[model samples]
Target: MIVNQFLVLGALLFSIGVYGVLVRRNAVLVLLSIELMLAAVNINLVAFGAFVDDAAAAGQVFALFVITVAAAEVGIGLAIVVLIFRNRSSANVDELDLMKW
Candidate 1:
């Protein structure tokens, strides 16, 4: 497959992720959308790393870092979601106002 194909796929996936984040009220769904966006970014990174001739392997390394960050994000995000559910009994994004004074 060509780099352009991967780029287009990534763009499509990212767009869907954005739509899910904007339209969904469920915290879990929003987190899943964020994961989708990260996956799209990873796809683009790997595609470019494979197609480019620089041989520095920076793109793959950066992708790995992004994966690590994403894992942490999921862990923290789920913990927050669980806490919210325990306190409020709902995972709806609109209902979360813990930061509001």
Candidate 2:
């Protein structure tokens, strides 16, 4: 139950997420990488909140907010990706240049 252990885990998760986002060209994979990053941030928030001597559950509450935002982002991002795939027939990030008019 060490805070440092949780921090290390969070850092590892964040690093993996960053690698996924940078290396994957698939739009869906990018979304998943973003979710992984958010999850890492939530882990840090909850770990700090549990270790700190604060009366209010600020870290947990903020984690909840991040979850909510992540949900909305996933919904909107998937919808956009779907639309792009439907129109372009491909979900590759490198081929999705919509502003090339």
Candidate 3:
């Protein structure tokens, strides 16, 4: 029952993140969507770790790794976005076609 609820919540959040990424043209919004997706993944991991109270803490460890990766991604992504904004005068992804070479 609780596991099902957690799965449902994770699924919903993932779907929302996907939708946001697909519908938004701003790079920042896309980054935010990615963060949402990562959050959903973390929720699933933590929930599973809590549900199965075994001696294995692999799920929790994986969640911590995911968090670390997400933080690094956000940092790098923001830096790139800022650079693009400074050069292009806007943060819209549609304007990034100049780099298609």
Q: Which candidate's TM-score is highest?
A: 2
Query: Distance (Å) between predicted and true CA of 65, model 1?
Result: 1.1
Q: Which pairs in model 1 have colliding backbones?
A: none
Tens digits of per-residue lDDT for model 3, 1-101: 37989989999999999999999999999999999999999989988988886687877988999999999999999999999999988999988786675
Q: How good is model 1 by TM-score?
A: 0.91
After superposition on all CA atoms, how large is the RMSD of candidate 2?
Answer: 1.8
Residue 93's lDDT in candidate 1:
92
Give stretches of model 3 more than 4 Å off.
Answer: 99-101
Please state the error at residue 1 of candidate 3 in Å. Answer: 6.2
Cα error, candidate 2, residue 81 (Å): 0.3
Residue-level lDDT of model 2, residues 1-101, one tens digit each, is: 57999999999999999999999999999999999999999999999999994899999999999999999999999999999899999999999676687
lDDT winner, 1 or 3: 1
1-96 in candidate 1: lDDT tens per residue?
A: 468999999999999999999999999999999999999999999899888846788779889999999999999999999998999999999976
lDDT of 1: 0.94
Q: Least accurate stretch of 10 residues (summed lDDT) in model 3?
A: 92-101
How high is each candidate's TM-score?
0.91, 0.93, 0.91
Each candidate: how many clashes?
A: 0, 0, 0
Candidate with the larger lDDT of 2 and 3: 2
Error of 1 at 54 (Å): 1.9
